[model samples]
Target: MSTTQNERLRGLLEPLVGAQGLDLEEIEVSQAGRRRVLRVVVDSDAGVDLDTVADVSRAISAKLDETDAMGEGEYVLEVGSPGADRPLTEHRHYVRATGRLAKLQLHEGGELVARILTVDDEGLDLEVPGVKGRKPTARRVGFGDIAKARVEVEFNRKNKQDELEQEEEEA
Candidate 1:
């Protein structure tokens, strides 16, 4: 899509999305075979569910139907949340990622995978796991120091229930 079209779409959809209590993370229009695809990524600190996505999709579809913003082309609308691996580009992203593991690349030069402990206006407090069974260390990283960051998926991470059960067993 053209830059102007994209901007127009953003302007048209952002208010709709905000009204529904979701942040408009992205808007993309792409070609897939003979049809165009419009993908809208929405998110919130509390996370997004399928039902919310469905509602948002219906609203977006209706809004598009009521307007010529799409320029008369057949397009499929896909509304969803950002995947677990989506890059953390905003402070709110980091805030929502609290207690999750993230791989951060520093602007000055290094990279590290750490669990996000807390997020404030200026930076993040991370717990960098140590090597060879060593204790994790606390580190502070300002938002500006991060060149890039993304949540890391952990298949074996224990949930709160599992941890609670383990503690009960030990007790």
Candidate 2:
């Protein structure tokens, strides 16, 4: 699609998505076989559930049907949330990722894999694990120092609070 048309689509759909308390993260139109596919990525601070995604999809489809935004061709509308591996671009993205492990690419050099402790307007506070079983050290990384960041999947992660609750339940 043309840039103007994409901008127009963004203008029209952003408000509709925002009305449901979600941000329109992306809009992409591509060809699939003989039909066009329109993919819309939506997200929120609290994250999006399956039902919420369905609701947004219906709203977006209806809005498109009511206009010539998709032109005369048949287009498939796919509205969904960003995956866990989505790049952390906006500050709100970092804020929403609090408590998650992130691998940040530093602007200066090197990469840092740390668990996010807190996020503020200035930067993020991370817990960088020390060598072996040593105590994890807290590190403050300014946003300006980050080139790119993505959430890392943690397997076999055990939460002490959760373990305690389970033990109490068993007791």
Candidate 3:
């Protein structure tokens, strides 16, 4: 898509997504065989569920049908949330990933896989897990220092609520 069409799509959809309490994470137009695909990525602090995806898809489809913003093409619309391992590009993305493990690549040279302890405007407070049974350490990283970051999926990691429940059971 041309830059103008991309801008137009954003202009038309951002507000509509925001009205539904979601952030417009991405908009992409790609080709598959003879068909074009318009992929819309929407997200929220609370996360996006299938129902929410469906509703937002309906709204976007309706809006697109009503506008010449898409120019004149038969395109398939796919609306969904960012995947589990999506890059943490925005401050809000980091904030939403709190309490999750993330792999952060630093600009100065080095990478750290840590659990996000907290997030503020300045940067992130991370708990870097220790190796060889050593104690974990705390580290601060300014957003400027991070070259790239993505949340790591931990299949066996227990969350605070689970730990708390276990402790209560023991008590």
Q: How does each model score on lDDT?
A: 0.96, 0.94, 0.96
Task: Write the residue-wise lDDT of candidate 2 on 12-111 in tens digits.
Answer: 9999999999999999999999899999999999999999999999999899999999999888999889997889999899989998899999999999
Q: Which stretches in model 2 have alpha-carbon errors above 4 Å?
A: 163-171
Candidate 1 Cα RMSD after full superposition onto the native fold (Å): 1.4
Query: For model 3, how does the per-residue alpha-carbon lDDT over 1-171 read when each residue is reduced to its tens digit?
Result: 889889999999999999999999999999988788999999999999999999999999999999988668688999999999999999999999999999999999999999999999999999999999999999999999999999998899987799999999999
- In candidate 3, how many Å is residue 70 off? 1.7
Better TM-score candidate (1, 2): 1
State every prediction's TM-score relative to the real structure.
Answer: 0.94, 0.92, 0.94
Task: State the local distance difference test value for candidate 1.
Answer: 0.96
Clashes of each: 0, 0, 0
Which lDDT value does model 1 have at 20? 96
